[model samples]
Target: MSDVAAYPVTLPAFVPEHAPPFPGQPPAIARAPRSDTLRCSTCSMRAICMPQGLTPDELKRMEALICPSRTIRQGETIYRANDSFQSIYAVRVGSFKTVVMHRDGREQVTGFHLTGDSLGLDGVSSGHHSCDAVALEDSKVCIIPFHLLETMCREVKVVQQHLHRMMGSEIVRESSQMMLLGTMSAEQRVATFLLNLSDRLRLRGYSPAEFHLRMTREEIGSYLGIKLETVSRMLSKFQRDGLVDTHGKDIRILDHESLVRV
Candidate 1:
Protein backbone atom coordinates (compact mmCIF):
# COMPACT_ATOMS: atom_id res chain seq x y z
CA MET A 1 0.00 0.00 0.00
CA SER A 2 1.09 3.58 -0.62
CA ASP A 3 2.53 5.41 2.37
CA VAL A 4 0.51 8.47 1.45
CA ALA A 5 -0.79 10.08 4.61
CA ALA A 6 -4.46 9.28 5.03
CA TYR A 7 -6.23 12.61 5.23
CA PRO A 8 -9.91 13.14 5.90
CA VAL A 9 -11.89 14.18 2.80
CA THR A 10 -15.60 14.91 2.92
CA LEU A 11 -18.19 15.04 0.19
CA PRO A 12 -20.88 17.65 0.43
CA ALA A 13 -23.93 15.67 1.46
CA PHE A 14 -25.94 15.54 -1.76
CA VAL A 15 -29.24 17.28 -1.19
CA PRO A 16 -31.27 17.48 -4.37
CA GLU A 17 -31.88 21.11 -5.10
CA HIS A 18 -35.20 20.38 -6.80
CA ALA A 19 -36.57 17.43 -4.86
CA PRO A 20 -40.36 17.34 -4.87
CA PRO A 21 -42.58 16.48 -1.92
CA PHE A 22 -44.51 13.15 -1.56
CA PRO A 23 -43.75 9.53 -2.45
CA GLY A 24 -43.80 8.34 -6.11
CA GLN A 25 -43.53 11.99 -7.18
CA PRO A 26 -42.30 13.38 -10.46
CA PRO A 27 -38.88 14.53 -9.23
CA ALA A 28 -36.98 12.87 -6.37
CA ILE A 29 -38.35 9.61 -4.94
CA ALA A 30 -38.19 8.66 -1.24
CA ARG A 31 -35.99 5.61 -1.57
CA ALA A 32 -32.57 6.03 -3.11
CA PRO A 33 -32.87 5.00 -6.78
CA ARG A 34 -31.16 1.83 -7.92
CA SER A 35 -28.06 2.61 -9.99
CA ASP A 36 -28.53 -0.43 -12.22
CA THR A 37 -32.10 0.61 -12.99
CA LEU A 38 -30.95 4.14 -13.66
CA ARG A 39 -28.08 2.95 -15.80
CA CYS A 40 -30.37 0.67 -17.73
CA SER A 41 -32.98 3.33 -18.34
CA THR A 42 -31.65 6.88 -17.93
CA CYS A 43 -27.87 7.08 -17.63
CA SER A 44 -26.03 9.03 -20.33
CA MET A 45 -23.18 6.58 -19.83
CA ARG A 46 -24.97 3.83 -21.82
CA ALA A 47 -23.09 4.82 -24.99
CA ILE A 48 -19.87 3.65 -23.38
CA CYS A 49 -21.38 0.43 -22.03
CA MET A 50 -22.98 -2.53 -23.79
CA PRO A 51 -26.11 -2.23 -21.70
CA GLN A 52 -27.68 0.07 -24.25
CA GLY A 53 -27.66 -2.57 -26.98
CA LEU A 54 -28.73 -5.50 -24.83
CA THR A 55 -32.14 -7.10 -25.13
CA PRO A 56 -34.58 -6.84 -22.22
CA ASP A 57 -33.78 -10.39 -21.16
CA GLU A 58 -30.04 -9.75 -21.39
CA LEU A 59 -30.37 -6.55 -19.36
CA LYS A 60 -32.33 -8.38 -16.70
CA ARG A 61 -29.74 -11.12 -16.60
CA MET A 62 -26.90 -8.63 -16.30
CA GLU A 63 -28.66 -6.68 -13.58
CA ALA A 64 -29.30 -9.86 -11.61
CA LEU A 65 -25.62 -10.82 -11.85
CA ILE A 66 -24.50 -7.64 -10.09
CA CYS A 67 -25.19 -6.37 -6.60
CA PRO A 68 -25.33 -2.72 -5.57
CA SER A 69 -23.27 -1.85 -2.49
CA ARG A 70 -23.61 0.92 0.10
CA THR A 71 -21.96 4.30 0.10
CA ILE A 72 -18.30 4.39 1.02
CA ARG A 73 -17.50 7.37 3.18
CA GLN A 74 -14.84 9.87 2.20
CA GLY A 75 -11.27 8.87 3.10
CA GLU A 76 -12.25 5.20 3.22
CA THR A 77 -10.13 2.62 1.41
CA ILE A 78 -12.31 0.44 -0.80
CA TYR A 79 -9.53 -1.92 -1.75
CA ARG A 80 -5.81 -2.11 -0.93
CA ALA A 81 -2.97 -3.12 -3.23
CA ASN A 82 -2.39 -6.86 -3.62
CA ASP A 83 -5.75 -7.74 -2.12
CA SER A 84 -7.78 -10.47 -3.79
CA PHE A 85 -9.72 -9.10 -6.72
CA GLN A 86 -13.03 -10.87 -6.35
CA SER A 87 -15.33 -8.43 -8.11
CA ILE A 88 -15.16 -5.50 -10.46
CA TYR A 89 -16.35 -2.27 -8.82
CA ALA A 90 -18.42 0.33 -10.65
CA VAL A 91 -18.79 3.81 -9.20
CA ARG A 92 -22.53 4.42 -9.10
CA VAL A 93 -22.19 7.74 -7.33
CA GLY A 94 -19.21 9.85 -6.24
CA SER A 95 -15.51 9.62 -7.09
CA PHE A 96 -12.49 7.52 -6.11
CA LYS A 97 -8.73 7.75 -6.57
CA THR A 98 -6.35 4.90 -7.30
CA VAL A 99 -2.74 5.27 -6.10
CA VAL A 100 0.53 3.40 -6.26
CA MET A 101 3.62 3.98 -4.13
CA HIS A 102 7.07 4.18 -5.60
CA ARG A 103 10.16 2.47 -4.19
CA ASP A 104 11.17 5.66 -2.38
CA GLY A 105 7.75 5.83 -0.67
CA ARG A 106 6.43 8.69 -2.77
CA GLU A 107 2.84 8.22 -3.94
CA GLN A 108 1.57 8.65 -7.47
CA VAL A 109 -2.16 8.87 -8.03
CA THR A 110 -2.86 6.53 -10.92
CA GLY A 111 -6.29 7.80 -11.79
CA PHE A 112 -9.57 9.23 -10.57
CA HIS A 113 -12.74 7.20 -11.22
CA LEU A 114 -15.98 9.16 -11.45
CA THR A 115 -19.64 8.12 -11.59
CA GLY A 116 -20.35 5.31 -14.10
CA ASP A 117 -16.67 4.35 -13.92
CA SER A 118 -15.25 0.95 -13.01
CA LEU A 119 -12.10 -0.13 -11.19
CA GLY A 120 -10.26 -3.48 -10.67
CA LEU A 121 -10.67 -4.45 -14.33
CA ASP A 122 -6.90 -4.49 -14.71
CA GLY A 123 -6.63 -7.12 -12.01
CA VAL A 124 -8.80 -9.66 -13.82
CA SER A 125 -5.94 -11.91 -14.82
CA SER A 126 -3.82 -11.51 -11.71
CA GLY A 127 -6.69 -11.89 -9.23
CA HIS A 128 -4.98 -9.27 -7.03
CA HIS A 129 -5.45 -5.53 -7.13
CA SER A 130 -2.51 -3.49 -8.41
CA CYS A 131 -3.25 -0.29 -6.51
CA ASP A 132 -5.21 1.16 -3.61
CA ALA A 133 -8.64 2.65 -4.28
CA VAL A 134 -9.78 5.38 -1.87
CA ALA A 135 -13.16 7.07 -1.86
CA LEU A 136 -13.01 10.84 -2.32
CA GLU A 137 -16.53 11.26 -0.96
CA ASP A 138 -19.64 9.43 0.13
CA SER A 139 -19.81 7.08 -2.84
CA LYS A 140 -21.76 4.02 -3.91
CA VAL A 141 -20.46 1.15 -6.07
CA CYS A 142 -22.02 -1.88 -7.80
CA ILE A 143 -19.95 -4.97 -7.29
CA ILE A 144 -19.97 -7.39 -10.25
CA PRO A 145 -18.36 -10.71 -9.57
CA PHE A 146 -15.71 -11.34 -12.20
CA HIS A 147 -16.73 -14.91 -12.97
CA LEU A 148 -20.33 -13.99 -13.60
CA LEU A 149 -19.48 -10.94 -15.68
CA GLU A 150 -16.93 -12.85 -17.70
CA THR A 151 -19.42 -15.58 -18.43
CA MET A 152 -22.06 -13.07 -19.47
CA CYS A 153 -19.59 -11.22 -21.68
CA ARG A 154 -18.78 -14.45 -23.47
CA GLU A 155 -22.43 -15.09 -24.13
CA VAL A 156 -23.46 -11.54 -24.98
CA LYS A 157 -21.93 -9.67 -27.88
CA VAL A 158 -23.00 -6.32 -26.52
CA VAL A 159 -21.37 -6.99 -23.19
CA GLN A 160 -18.06 -7.75 -24.89
CA GLN A 161 -18.24 -4.52 -26.90
CA HIS A 162 -19.05 -2.51 -23.81
CA LEU A 163 -16.12 -3.91 -21.88
CA HIS A 164 -13.83 -3.20 -24.81
CA ARG A 165 -14.99 0.42 -24.99
CA MET A 166 -14.50 0.89 -21.25
CA MET A 167 -10.92 -0.41 -21.44
CA GLY A 168 -10.25 1.87 -24.39
CA SER A 169 -11.49 4.85 -22.44
CA GLU A 170 -9.22 4.02 -19.51
CA ILE A 171 -6.22 3.82 -21.84
CA VAL A 172 -7.07 7.18 -23.39
CA ARG A 173 -7.39 8.79 -19.97
CA GLU A 174 -3.99 7.48 -18.90
CA SER A 175 -2.43 8.77 -22.09
CA SER A 176 -4.00 12.16 -21.55
CA GLN A 177 -2.67 12.28 -18.00
CA MET A 178 0.86 11.48 -19.22
CA MET A 179 0.66 14.26 -21.78
CA LEU A 180 -0.67 16.72 -19.21
CA LEU A 181 2.08 15.84 -16.74
CA GLY A 182 4.73 16.26 -19.43
CA THR A 183 3.54 19.52 -21.02
CA MET A 184 1.31 21.54 -18.70
CA SER A 185 2.48 24.30 -16.35
CA ALA A 186 1.44 24.27 -12.67
CA GLU A 187 -1.23 26.89 -13.32
CA GLN A 188 -2.46 25.03 -16.36
CA ARG A 189 -2.53 21.78 -14.42
CA VAL A 190 -4.67 23.29 -11.69
CA ALA A 191 -7.03 24.86 -14.20
CA THR A 192 -7.35 21.64 -16.15
CA PHE A 193 -8.10 19.63 -13.02
CA LEU A 194 -10.84 22.04 -11.97
CA LEU A 195 -12.33 22.02 -15.44
CA ASN A 196 -12.30 18.23 -15.52
CA LEU A 197 -14.02 18.06 -12.14
CA SER A 198 -16.63 20.57 -13.28
CA ASP A 199 -17.32 18.60 -16.43
CA ARG A 200 -17.61 15.35 -14.47
CA LEU A 201 -20.03 16.81 -11.97
CA ARG A 202 -22.16 18.16 -14.80
CA LEU A 203 -22.30 14.69 -16.34
CA ARG A 204 -23.55 13.34 -13.00
CA GLY A 205 -26.51 15.79 -13.19
CA TYR A 206 -25.13 18.45 -10.85
CA SER A 207 -24.18 22.06 -11.36
CA PRO A 208 -21.08 22.08 -13.52
CA ALA A 209 -19.62 25.48 -12.78
CA GLU A 210 -20.71 25.65 -9.14
CA PHE A 211 -20.06 22.73 -6.78
CA HIS A 212 -18.15 21.84 -3.64
CA LEU A 213 -14.72 20.24 -3.95
CA ARG A 214 -14.35 16.75 -2.52
CA MET A 215 -10.55 16.58 -2.30
CA THR A 216 -8.40 19.07 -0.41
CA ARG A 217 -5.97 21.46 -2.12
CA GLU A 218 -3.07 19.28 -1.02
CA GLU A 219 -4.55 16.20 -2.62
CA ILE A 220 -5.33 18.21 -5.74
CA GLY A 221 -1.72 19.35 -5.85
CA SER A 222 -0.48 15.80 -5.39
CA TYR A 223 -2.67 14.56 -8.23
CA LEU A 224 -1.58 17.42 -10.49
CA GLY A 225 2.14 17.08 -9.70
CA ILE A 226 2.49 20.43 -7.96
CA LYS A 227 3.00 21.88 -4.48
CA LEU A 228 0.18 22.74 -2.11
CA GLU A 229 1.22 26.40 -2.01
CA THR A 230 1.15 26.54 -5.81
CA VAL A 231 -2.37 25.16 -5.87
CA SER A 232 -3.48 27.78 -3.29
CA ARG A 233 -1.74 30.60 -5.17
CA MET A 234 -3.28 29.64 -8.51
CA LEU A 235 -6.74 29.42 -6.96
CA SER A 236 -6.25 32.82 -5.38
CA LYS A 237 -5.18 34.23 -8.70
CA PHE A 238 -8.32 32.78 -10.31
CA GLN A 239 -10.42 34.40 -7.60
CA ARG A 240 -8.69 37.72 -8.15
CA ASP A 241 -9.31 37.50 -11.88
CA GLY A 242 -13.02 36.78 -11.33
CA LEU A 243 -12.57 33.31 -12.78
CA VAL A 244 -13.94 31.65 -9.66
CA ASP A 245 -15.39 32.34 -6.23
CA THR A 246 -13.86 30.52 -3.28
CA HIS A 247 -15.15 30.69 0.27
CA GLY A 248 -13.06 28.45 2.46
CA LYS A 249 -13.53 24.96 0.94
CA ASP A 250 -16.41 25.87 -1.36
CA ILE A 251 -15.54 26.89 -4.95
CA ARG A 252 -17.96 28.27 -7.50
CA ILE A 253 -16.75 28.90 -11.00
CA LEU A 254 -17.77 32.45 -11.89
CA ASP A 255 -16.20 32.35 -15.34
CA HIS A 256 -15.42 28.80 -16.42
CA GLU A 257 -14.05 29.85 -19.80
CA SER A 258 -11.55 32.22 -18.18
CA LEU A 259 -10.30 29.47 -15.87
CA VAL A 260 -10.00 27.04 -18.80
CA ARG A 261 -8.03 29.56 -20.86
CA VAL A 262 -5.56 29.94 -18.01
Candidate 2:
Protein backbone atom coordinates (compact mmCIF):
# COMPACT_ATOMS: atom_id res chain seq x y z
CA MET A 1 0.00 0.00 0.00
CA SER A 2 1.07 3.58 -0.46
CA ASP A 3 2.07 6.01 2.30
CA VAL A 4 0.35 9.22 1.31
CA ALA A 5 0.74 7.77 -2.13
CA ALA A 6 1.65 4.32 -0.80
CA TYR A 7 -1.34 2.08 -2.21
CA PRO A 8 -4.65 2.08 -0.10
CA VAL A 9 -2.20 1.70 2.91
CA THR A 10 -0.19 -0.13 -0.31
CA LEU A 11 -4.01 0.33 -2.63
CA PRO A 12 -5.97 0.53 0.61
CA ALA A 13 -6.47 4.29 -0.08
CA PHE A 14 -10.12 5.26 -0.14
CA VAL A 15 -11.70 4.81 -3.59
CA PRO A 16 -14.43 7.31 -4.46
CA GLU A 17 -15.28 8.25 -8.01
CA HIS A 18 -14.73 11.97 -7.66
CA ALA A 19 -12.87 9.93 -10.57
CA PRO A 20 -11.60 8.24 -13.26
CA PRO A 21 -6.67 1.20 -15.82
CA PHE A 22 -5.23 -1.45 -17.85
CA PRO A 23 -3.21 -4.64 -17.80
CA GLY A 24 0.61 -4.72 -17.67
CA GLN A 25 3.56 -6.89 -16.73
CA PRO A 26 6.03 -6.33 -13.89
CA PRO A 27 8.93 -3.97 -14.47
CA ALA A 28 13.35 -2.41 -12.70
CA ILE A 29 14.46 1.01 -12.23
CA ALA A 30 18.05 0.10 -13.14
CA ARG A 31 19.94 2.96 -14.68
CA ALA A 32 23.51 4.12 -15.29
CA PRO A 33 25.43 5.26 -12.22
CA ARG A 34 25.56 8.96 -11.48
CA SER A 35 28.66 11.16 -11.06
CA ASP A 36 27.74 12.09 -7.48
CA THR A 37 27.18 9.42 -4.85
CA LEU A 38 23.68 9.26 -3.36
CA ARG A 39 24.49 7.35 -0.19
CA CYS A 40 21.57 6.73 2.16
CA SER A 41 23.65 8.14 5.03
CA THR A 42 24.26 11.36 3.13
CA CYS A 43 20.61 11.77 2.24
CA SER A 44 18.74 14.69 3.81
CA MET A 45 16.20 12.60 5.70
CA ARG A 46 18.57 9.74 6.57
CA ALA A 47 17.87 9.83 10.27
CA ILE A 48 14.21 9.05 9.71
CA CYS A 49 14.26 7.01 6.50
CA MET A 50 13.58 3.26 6.40
CA PRO A 51 17.25 2.25 6.16
CA GLN A 52 18.17 4.33 9.19
CA GLY A 53 19.11 1.48 11.49
CA LEU A 54 20.74 -0.90 8.97
CA THR A 55 24.31 -2.02 9.57
CA PRO A 56 27.03 -0.64 7.30
CA ASP A 57 27.13 -3.85 5.21
CA GLU A 58 23.35 -4.06 5.04
CA LEU A 59 23.19 -0.42 4.07
CA LYS A 60 25.74 -1.05 1.30
CA ARG A 61 23.58 -3.81 -0.17
CA MET A 62 20.54 -1.56 0.12
CA GLU A 63 22.41 1.21 -1.69
CA ALA A 64 23.07 -1.11 -4.59
CA LEU A 65 19.31 -1.36 -5.10
CA ILE A 66 18.75 2.39 -5.36
CA CYS A 67 19.00 4.44 -8.49
CA PRO A 68 20.33 7.99 -8.00
CA SER A 69 17.68 10.16 -6.43
CA ARG A 70 16.15 12.61 -8.88
CA THR A 71 13.73 15.47 -8.63
CA ILE A 72 10.11 14.86 -9.56
CA ARG A 73 8.53 18.18 -10.53
CA GLN A 74 5.17 19.04 -9.10
CA GLY A 75 2.32 17.41 -11.02
CA GLU A 76 4.63 14.84 -12.57
CA THR A 77 3.19 11.34 -12.55
CA ILE A 78 5.75 9.03 -10.92
CA TYR A 79 3.77 6.02 -12.12
CA ARG A 80 0.39 5.75 -13.75
CA ALA A 81 -2.29 3.27 -12.83
CA ASN A 82 -1.56 -0.24 -14.19
CA ASP A 83 2.01 0.54 -15.17
CA SER A 84 4.43 -2.29 -14.69
CA PHE A 85 5.52 -2.40 -11.04
CA GLN A 86 9.21 -2.93 -10.54
CA SER A 87 9.93 -1.14 -7.27
CA ILE A 88 8.53 0.71 -4.32
CA TYR A 89 9.95 4.19 -3.69
CA ALA A 90 11.00 5.94 -0.46
CA VAL A 91 10.24 9.61 -0.36
CA ARG A 92 13.40 11.62 0.36
CA VAL A 93 12.08 15.12 -0.03
CA GLY A 94 8.72 16.86 -0.52
CA SER A 95 5.47 14.89 -0.73
CA PHE A 96 3.11 12.97 -3.04
CA LYS A 97 -0.55 12.04 -3.40
CA THR A 98 -1.82 8.87 -5.09
CA VAL A 99 -5.05 8.58 -7.01
CA VAL A 100 -6.91 5.73 -8.69
CA MET A 101 -8.97 6.42 -11.76
CA HIS A 102 -12.24 4.58 -11.81
CA ARG A 103 -13.83 2.94 -14.86
CA ASP A 104 -16.26 5.83 -14.93
CA GLY A 105 -13.42 8.40 -15.27
CA ARG A 106 -13.55 9.65 -11.72
CA GLU A 107 -10.35 9.73 -9.66
CA GLN A 108 -10.21 8.72 -6.01
CA VAL A 109 -7.25 9.76 -3.92
CA THR A 110 -5.76 6.88 -1.94
CA GLY A 111 -2.98 8.39 0.17
CA PHE A 112 -0.34 11.07 0.57
CA HIS A 113 3.42 10.42 0.94
CA LEU A 114 5.83 12.56 2.89
CA THR A 115 9.57 12.36 3.36
CA GLY A 116 10.70 8.97 4.71
CA ASP A 117 7.56 7.16 3.52
CA SER A 118 7.36 4.54 0.74
CA LEU A 119 5.10 4.17 -2.28
CA GLY A 120 4.26 1.49 -4.91
CA LEU A 121 2.70 -1.36 -2.93
CA ASP A 122 0.00 -1.79 -5.57
CA GLY A 123 2.46 -3.90 -7.54
CA VAL A 124 3.01 -6.50 -4.82
CA SER A 125 0.01 -8.74 -5.50
CA SER A 126 -0.12 -8.15 -9.22
CA GLY A 127 2.72 -7.52 -11.66
CA HIS A 128 1.28 -4.09 -12.47
CA HIS A 129 0.64 -0.99 -10.39
CA SER A 130 -2.91 -0.39 -9.19
CA CYS A 131 -2.84 3.40 -8.99
CA ASP A 132 -1.11 6.64 -9.96
CA ALA A 133 1.58 8.50 -7.95
CA VAL A 134 1.83 12.23 -8.53
CA ALA A 135 4.24 14.67 -6.96
CA LEU A 136 2.56 17.26 -4.77
CA GLU A 137 5.70 19.38 -4.82
CA ASP A 138 9.17 19.37 -6.33
CA SER A 139 10.20 16.06 -4.76
CA LYS A 140 12.68 13.17 -4.78
CA VAL A 141 12.37 9.43 -4.05
CA CYS A 142 14.67 6.48 -3.36
CA ILE A 143 13.57 3.74 -5.73
CA ILE A 144 14.06 0.27 -4.23
CA PRO A 145 13.66 -2.65 -6.58
CA PHE A 146 11.08 -4.97 -5.02
CA HIS A 147 13.02 -8.16 -5.71
CA LEU A 148 16.18 -6.69 -4.24
CA LEU A 149 14.28 -5.66 -1.15
CA GLU A 150 12.81 -9.14 -0.80
CA THR A 151 16.24 -10.68 -1.22
CA MET A 152 17.68 -8.40 1.43
CA CYS A 153 14.77 -9.17 3.73
CA ARG A 154 15.71 -12.85 3.63
CA GLU A 155 18.99 -11.96 5.31
CA VAL A 156 17.84 -8.94 7.31
CA LYS A 157 15.00 -9.90 9.59
CA VAL A 158 14.45 -6.31 10.70
CA VAL A 159 13.81 -5.07 7.17
CA GLN A 160 11.22 -7.75 6.57
CA GLN A 161 9.41 -7.00 9.81
CA HIS A 162 9.40 -3.29 9.13
CA LEU A 163 8.05 -3.80 5.63
CA HIS A 164 5.23 -5.94 6.97
CA ARG A 165 4.40 -3.38 9.62
CA MET A 166 4.46 -0.51 7.15
CA MET A 167 2.11 -2.31 4.76
CA GLY A 168 -0.24 -3.24 7.60
CA SER A 169 -0.30 0.37 8.77
CA GLU A 170 -1.32 1.50 5.31
CA ILE A 171 -4.23 -0.97 5.37
CA VAL A 172 -5.48 0.33 8.71
CA ARG A 173 -5.07 3.95 7.67
CA GLU A 174 -7.08 3.46 4.49
CA SER A 175 -9.84 1.63 6.33
CA SER A 176 -10.07 4.52 8.79
CA GLN A 177 -10.28 6.95 5.87
CA MET A 178 -13.19 4.97 4.45
CA MET A 179 -14.99 5.16 7.75
CA LEU A 180 -14.25 8.87 8.05
CA LEU A 181 -15.62 9.56 4.59
CA GLY A 182 -18.71 7.46 5.13
CA THR A 183 -19.60 8.60 8.63
CA MET A 184 -18.13 12.01 9.43
CA SER A 185 -19.67 15.43 8.94
CA ALA A 186 -17.75 18.29 7.27
CA GLU A 187 -16.34 19.63 10.54
CA GLN A 188 -15.41 16.17 11.72
CA ARG A 189 -13.70 15.48 8.43
CA VAL A 190 -11.57 18.61 8.63
CA ALA A 191 -10.70 17.91 12.24
CA THR A 192 -9.64 14.38 11.45
CA PHE A 193 -7.54 15.57 8.56
CA LEU A 194 -5.67 18.03 10.76
CA LEU A 195 -4.96 15.45 13.43
CA ASN A 196 -3.73 12.86 10.92
CA LEU A 197 -1.31 15.27 9.27
CA SER A 198 -0.22 16.54 12.67
CA ASP A 199 0.59 13.03 13.87
CA ARG A 200 2.59 12.17 10.75
CA LEU A 201 4.58 15.39 11.09
CA ARG A 202 5.17 14.72 14.75
CA LEU A 203 6.52 11.27 13.85
CA ARG A 204 9.06 13.04 11.62
CA GLY A 205 10.09 15.18 14.64
CA TYR A 206 8.28 18.22 13.43
CA SER A 207 5.71 20.07 15.52
CA PRO A 208 2.34 18.36 15.54
CA ALA A 209 0.50 21.53 16.43
CA GLU A 210 1.87 23.57 13.51
CA PHE A 211 2.76 22.69 9.92
CA HIS A 212 2.15 23.73 6.36
CA LEU A 213 -0.27 21.74 4.30
CA ARG A 214 1.40 20.73 1.07
CA MET A 215 -1.94 19.56 -0.20
CA THR A 216 -4.40 22.16 -1.53
CA ARG A 217 -7.84 22.82 -0.10
CA GLU A 218 -9.43 21.12 -3.06
CA GLU A 219 -7.28 18.05 -2.62
CA ILE A 220 -8.13 18.01 1.08
CA GLY A 221 -11.81 18.23 0.22
CA SER A 222 -11.49 15.36 -2.24
CA TYR A 223 -9.73 13.19 0.32
CA LEU A 224 -12.25 14.12 3.01
CA GLY A 225 -15.29 13.64 0.71
CA ILE A 226 -16.47 17.24 0.75
CA LYS A 227 -16.48 20.16 -1.66
CA LEU A 228 -13.50 22.52 -1.71
CA GLU A 229 -15.81 25.32 -0.62
CA THR A 230 -16.82 23.29 2.37
CA VAL A 231 -13.20 22.63 3.25
CA SER A 232 -12.54 26.37 3.21
CA ARG A 233 -15.59 27.09 5.31
CA MET A 234 -14.59 24.51 7.84
CA LEU A 235 -11.15 26.02 8.17
CA SER A 236 -12.69 29.43 8.70
CA LYS A 237 -14.97 27.95 11.27
CA PHE A 238 -12.08 26.29 13.03
CA GLN A 239 -10.19 29.56 13.11
CA ARG A 240 -13.15 31.54 14.42
CA ASP A 241 -13.81 28.97 17.10
CA GLY A 242 -10.14 29.20 18.21
CA LEU A 243 -9.52 25.54 17.47
CA VAL A 244 -6.96 26.46 14.81
CA ASP A 245 -5.36 29.37 13.07
CA THR A 246 -4.82 29.28 9.33
CA HIS A 247 -2.88 31.56 7.06
CA GLY A 248 -3.10 29.96 3.67
CA LYS A 249 -1.32 26.59 3.96
CA ASP A 250 0.37 27.27 7.28
CA ILE A 251 -1.93 26.10 10.07
CA ARG A 252 -1.63 26.07 13.85
CA ILE A 253 -3.91 23.97 15.93
CA LEU A 254 -5.01 26.07 18.91
CA ASP A 255 -7.19 23.46 20.54
CA HIS A 256 -6.20 19.93 19.66
CA GLU A 257 -8.67 18.52 22.17
CA SER A 258 -11.54 20.49 20.70
CA LEU A 259 -10.69 19.12 17.27
CA VAL A 260 -10.59 15.63 18.74
CA ARG A 261 -14.02 16.32 20.12
CA VAL A 262 -15.24 17.38 16.67
| The best candidate in terms of lDDT | 2
List the global CA lDDT of all models: 0.68, 0.74
Q: Could you give candidate 1's per-residue lDDT for residues 138-222 as a string of tens digits?
A: 7876666677778988999878777776667667777778777899998898888888878766766679878877677877777
Q: Please report, as a residue range, the 10-residue window in candidate 1 with the lowest summed lDDT.
A: 1-10
Candidate 1 wrong stretches, greater than 4 Å: 1-50
Task: Give the per-residue Cα lDDT of candidate 1 at 155.
Answer: 98
Regions more than 4 Å wrong, model 2: 1-36, 51-53
Residue-level lDDT of model 2, residues 57-113, one tens digit each, is: 777676676656655668776677777777778887889898887789877777888
Among all windows of ten consecutive residues in candidate 2, which has the lowest summed lDDT? 6-15
**TM accuracy, model 1:** 0.78
Error of 2 at 75 (Å): 0.6
State the TM-score for model 2: 0.84
